[model samples]
Target: MNIEIKVAKKSFNYSGPKNWEETEPWLYAKIFGIGKQLAEKPHALFALPQMIFQIPTNVLQFLFDRNAMRMVGVKDEEAQDEVMGQGYALLKIAQSFANSEAPFSWKVPKVKAAFLGYNYYGPGDSLGMLTFEEFWFAEAAYERNDTNALIAVLYRRDPYRKQTFSEELTEKTLKDLQALPELTKEMIVFNYQGCRLGFSKKFKHVFPKKSVEKDDEQQPKKTKKNSGGWLQVAIGMAGDSSVEFDALRKLNVIVALQMVENKLIKVKQLKRKTK
Candidate 1:
């Protein structure tokens, strides 16, 4: 949304984000960085105008001060109050935009001509079509907090067809993604997180929740040894066959997860029978 204010024969126009979908990634970063400061210091509210509008510091100071308003021919108290009210209204709008929660919509917008005249597209709204390899690499990238890598994994040159995963292609695509606008990167991240959330909900059994108990004060806690991570899981699924592993990775994520769940259930059943 755009708002324009005319004061002392000069016009100042500013635009604020209406929602997460419309917000730039850099702006979101700024808002997140200042969130704690905004909470702790009421004076930090003045920073909002600068962030949202890119307003000059001197202009902001002049606009924020009542004495400055008087010097600029806004001597009438009522007029000054009205101008201040507009400023306050703009601040409120900005704050609300920053504070609003993002809706869970796993719809990633397409990036046209990202590289080699190929339009890159994300998995569908629920990521139902994502292959196991794609999901694995994307999840890994997300864990590492590597946005470029995540985007390269999630988006593909073909929208209607599945493509084989290629390290060379992914490397080249990552460079392309880095060159794109920050807003595009932000949107992709937002959609990717939403997709991940949906995937977790859909595969709740695969991601069983573990409750951690607090350690005793007098005794040191015994830490559990780490099991092998995704690499181990992939090896187990492949059963020492490289071809089988490649095929498994190409399987749809939902199907692969179901296979895992079924195997786990069978393992439990066998244990019960033995007992």
Candidate 2:
């Protein structure tokens, strides 16, 4: 099955503190680097928990058109068989990207081509506050979820600008964020602890109900087979705050996803007992 995907370019006019460009140019560049990396190897973004998750807009358009063809009986018999196959094909592609850590039986070539086809600009077309928060605090975001880590960096940038949120929920969140310690070099690393704790509190709302499991809340139960086995092996002896540690983390995640795509390792699965 062949499907064409096109994404329109959208600009997010970041209006962060003006001093950031002068004081932390690396952080500024890293934000752009992150977007480029995602475009090149989307499995990196897929491995991490997003603030929001949904079917990519371009993929959804394909699904809708496939269904529309079925209703119209365009090509009649061919459409019936091809449309069914295309649906499965779409699912396989989405699954590979969505379950980034899970083992896969096969690598769908077209899905891979689709992922790499477009240049992504800051989590393009997806509705999430992830890029907003990450771009706002690139350096510290490495070890933390963007949402909670936002306060620490934003506070350092401009405390008064934080008050300009017109959204009621955001306005309320800012009031709560004041409880965190003032941003410092030491606090950059330490603040991640709070960011993690905050995600734990909010996971129920952010992730789907079916995705979360009773035994493990960290990742979806379906993809827990490999767990962090390879990741640990990939980044040994690297300190959390070091540049090497961050690079290895991204590399390993991509490697693991590739291993899954190529069917290199056996994924653990629960055995079914015969009734």
The lDDT values for all models are 0.70, 0.33
Q: Which pairs of residues collide in candidate 1?
A: none
Give per-residue CA lDDT, model 1, range 197-264, as digits (tens): 65556655455544344576755455444444344565597897989998998888878877776665
**Candidate 2 ranges with C-alpha deviation above 4 Å:** 1-67, 101-155, 159-275
TM-score, prediction 2? 0.23
lDDT over C-alpha atoms for residue 263 of model 1: 66
**Model 2 lDDT tens row, 195-228:** 3333334332222123335445555455333334
Model 1's alpha-carbon lDDT is 0.70
Question: What are the TM-scores, per candidate, against the unseen true structure?
Answer: 0.57, 0.23
In model 1, the worst 10-residue window by lDDT is: 222-231
Q: In model 2, how large is the Cα lDDT of residue 206?
A: 24
